[model samples]
Target: MKAAVLFEAKQPLSIEEVTIAKPAAHEVLIRTVAVGVCRSDLHFVDGAYPHAMPTIPGHEAAGVVEAVGEEVRCVKVGDHVVTCLSAYCGQCEYCVTGRMSLCIDAAVRRPKGAPPRLMLGDVPVAQMLNLSAYAELMLVHEHACVAIDRDMPLDRAALLGCAVTTGAGAVFNTTDVTPGETVCVVGCGGIGLAAVNAAKIAGAGRIIALDPVPEKRAMAEKLGATHSFDSAAETVADEVVALTRGGVHHAIEAVGRPQSAATAVKVLRRGGTATILGMMPLGEKVGLSAMDLLAGKRLQGGLMGSNRFPVDIPRLVDFYLRGLLDLDTIIADRLPLDRINEAFDELRRGETTRSVVTFG
Candidate 1:
């Protein structure tokens, strides 16, 4: 199989002939159909986040099951599925507590001394996250994937794995956004735009979308934002507060920047909550004032939207099929595996909502 392999930080990923091992117990092998070029992958490739070298960088993906281990019962051969990075061990404390996204059990991966799942000649290639979906095929734990309806298009289904799940899940699960709530979303990228769409579905009384890019702000309005502001004006937070009388009930930060995260806190009403969904730098810190906390303003971080993939994804599929979720507008371009570098270039420029890699 051919895969895009990252050898060094801030370097281009090279296309190489890689070898994929068969499924281990509780693992599944999938034929990659569509993989979204997400901003999270850029975090590792551009050295914003540290990762093991010689790894395959991709996680947001949708594919068809080609094979499964003897103990795998969640999906069968030929079943369509979406892959997630939040793989869990069913017996973990977090899993039993209904917080499966926080499960960090080491047993989810093969035991030490076991053969690698991916190899380039004789050297082992570390898999990015749990599902290295940048390749022609992926071998991952069954818990990392959820089977979805076959009618969902693979390219659109790929978005549900990460951007959609993280964005919408933050609204539906992480924050208590009531039907009449006011929402202000920072950054109009894939994740931010999804939050705007979900706010509309949640019946937000007013949805304000903020971004420096005019194109993205326009896109946010088309998706569902009642108001859009260009952060370049240098008054996004004030504009949001002004539009909603005092401040919004919920403010979501999706850019992963310290400033954007701070703005999420600035645009919240009393007793409102700010959910930070973007993956910020490892050592960076976001600051908030003591007065804000005293007023009952809450700032929180969400991992993979604190998702329970097994239940959330199928219902998300239903939302898409019913024309509630806007996957069609989310896709900006579709490229082949060999052109992965160009896809990342576009991502860095924030030129597109999402670029998808379609396999043959």
Candidate 2:
């Protein structure tokens, strides 16, 4: 299999041939079709996030199941599926209680001391997430994927594997935005645009999109944002509050940062809830005033849109098929696997929304 391996922080991923292990009883093997580039991957690339080196760095992907382990029944060989890094152990307290995203036992990847999923000769390469979709193949636990309609294009379905689900999920499941409400999403990247579209579908009376990039802001408007702005300047929250009369019913922080997290909090109405969808650094603290809690403002984090993939992925696919979800527009371009380095280059230059690497 061919994979783009991360060898150093702030360095380009090098393409290399690697060996992919087969599936275990609880796993499935997939022939990778399309993998979407993500900001989280960029964080690890730029040293903003920490991880083991020589990693196969990709999670958002869609492909066809080539084989399944003995115990796997959700999908079969020849079934098209979208891969998720979320592997939930059904027996966990969180999983049993409906908060599957918080299932501590699930998504507990391979044991720490074991050989990683990808390897170059004898050199082990860790997977960025449980699903190392950057490669031509993936051997992942069955719980880390959801079977989708075969007709959905692999490129678009790949977004559902991560950004789409994370963004739309935060709005639909986490914050539970109600109709006639107002929303402000800070960051007009892929996730932020998904939030804006989700907000529109949720019947939000006002949707404000904020970002430092003009192209992103424009894209957000096309995705259903009623207004857009350059958030590079401060006072964005104040502007949002002023425009919404009092404040928005909900705010989403899609950029992983303390400033954006705080801004997501500051722009809400008295009882409004803020959902931080951004993947914040592992140990970095999000400063919040103790007084804010007393004021009835709430802050919460979400993982993978708090998704139950079997249910959500299908609904998202239907939405896309029915012309509700905008995957084609969101996909700025597609590149062959060998051009994986170019995909990352476009991401760094902010030249595209998502650059999917296709198996060629």
Candidate 3:
């Protein structure tokens, strides 16, 4: 199998021939169909988070199941599936509590010193978030993937794995915006735009989409934003407060930055909540006023939009099929594995919503 491996930070991802392993008892083998190039992948390439060297970087993906382990019952061979990073161990405290997104059981992956599920010749390269859809094939825990309708295109289904799940989940699950709620999303990338679309679907009275890039603001309006801001203008928070009678019902910080996180907290209404969906660097903290927090406002975080992927994905696919969800508009480009470097470069520029690697 051929895969694009990260050789260094901000460098080209080298395409190489690699061997992928078969599934274990609780895993499945998927032949890559299409994988969305996500911003989260860039976080690893740029060293935002520490990952093993020569890693395969891709998670937002949908592919066909080539094989399944003995323990797999949810899907069968030749089934079209989308992968989710939030693998849950059903017996964990979090899973039993219906907070499976926070499941921390050791059932998914083995600890260090144990044999890995994937290998490159003699070297054991890490799989980013466990999906590794950049390669021609992937082996992942059965719980980490969900089967979608065959009618939905694999390329579009791939985006639902991450961007759509994160963006829509943040709105429908985490924040629970009422019909008349006012929302402000801090970034207009894939997840941020998803938030805008979700806000529209949620019937937000006023949706303010904020991004430094003026062009994304335009895209946001097309998606569902009632108003869009460049965010480079004077004070973004002040502008939101002025637009809304008081403060926004919810403020979402999709950009993983300390300043944007703090800004989300500051702009919420007296009892509103701010949902942080970005994967911020380890040990970084966002500061907030104690007085404001005491006023009943709250700060929260969402992992995979607090998703139950198996159930949520099918419904989203239905939403897309019925013309409620718009995957056709968000896709910007589709390239091959060899062009992975170009895809990463385009991501750094914030040039488009999503780019997918379509396997031949």
Candidate 4:
């Protein structure tokens, strides 16, 4: 199987003939169909987040199950599925308490001294976030993926794995934006756009989309934003407060930058919560002013949108099929796996919503 292998930080991923092992107990092997090129992967590529070398980085993906190992009753060999990075161990406290995304048990992974799931010749290739979907085939724990309807297109379903799950789940699960509430989503990339669309679906009274890119702001409006603004504006936060006559009920930080997170906090009304969905630089601190604390303003991180993938993903697919969720507009381009670097280049340019790498 061919995969884009990252040999070093701040370097391009080279296409190599990698070997994928068969599923271990509780694991499933999938034939990659489509995977989204996300900024999170770019962070690792640029060395913002350090990882073991010679790893496969792609995660947001959907595919067909080619095989399943023992105890993998959640899916069958011919099922269609979407992969998630938040693989959980069913017995963990987090999973039992209904917070499956926070499960960090090693039970889902192979024990030490066990043969690796992937190899390049004689060397082991580390899997990125459990599901290394950049390769032609992915071997992951059955808990990392959930079977979805066959009618859903793989390209669009891929987004549901990460971008959509994170964005939409932030609204539905994290912030729980009630009808008639105001929401301001920072960044109009794939995640931000999904938040805007989900805010609309949640019946947010005033959906505000913020981004420096004009085209993305326009796209947000088409999806559901009642208003849009250039995040680059010096007084953008003030402008949002003024427009809402105070501040929004919920503010989502999707840009994964300190400045964007600050803006999200700044645009929140009293008692409002700011959900940080983007993965900011490690060790970077985000906090509230003394005044904000007094005002009951809260800031929280929504890891993987606080998702329970087994239940959330299937419903999301239904939302798309019902025409309530717009995955088509969020997709900007589709390229073959070999051209994956070009997709990253576009992401670095800060243009385009999402670029998907397709396997043919």
Instruction: Point to the candidate with the largest TM-score.
Output: 4
Model 3, position 49: C-alpha lDDT score: 79
Weakest lDDT window of 10 consecutive positions for candidate 4:
337-346
Measure candidate 3: CA RMSD.
1.6
After superposition on all C-alphas, the RMSD of every candidate to the true structure, in Å, is 0.8, 1.9, 1.6, 0.6
lDDT (Cα, tens digit) per residue for candidate 2, span 1-360: 788888999888888999987776777899999998898888888898888888888999999999987788788899999988777877888888888777757344667676666788898877777877888899988888889987899889999988999999988899888898999999877888888998888888899998888888889999999998778778788888899887888999998887888888888888888889887877877755776777788888888899987788889999899988887778888888778777777877865777788886
Q: In model 1, which residue pairs have backbone atoms overlapping below 3 Å?
A: none
- When sorted by TM-score, best at the front, the candidate numbers are 4, 1, 3, 2
Model 3 stretches with alpha carbons more than 4 Å out: 110-115
Off by over 4 Å in 2: 106-116
Query: What TM-score does candidate 1 get on C-alpha atoms?
Result: 0.99
Clashing pairs in 3: none
Which residue runs of candidate 1 sit more than 4 Å off their true CA positions?
none
Candidate 3 per-residue C-alpha lDDT over 192-274 given as tens digits, one digit per residue, 9 for 90 to 100 = 88889888988999999988887788989999899987776768888888888778999998988887898788678788889
**TM-score of every candidate:** 0.99, 0.94, 0.96, 0.99
Q: Which ranges of candidate 4 are over 4 A from the true structure?
A: none
Per-residue lDDT tens digits for candidate 4, residues 1-360, read 999999999888899999999888999999999999999999999999999989999999999999999988999999999999999999989999999999999998889999999999999999899988899999999999999999999999999999999999999999999999999999999999999999999999999999999999999999999999999999999999999999999999999999999999999999999999988999998999999999999999999989999999999999999999999999999999889888888999999999999998
Q: What's the alpha carbon RMSD for model 4? A: 0.6
Q: Rank the candidates by lDDT, best first.
A: 4, 1, 3, 2
Clashing pairs in 4: none
Candidate 2: global Cα-lDDT?
0.85
Error of 2 at 135 (Å): 0.7
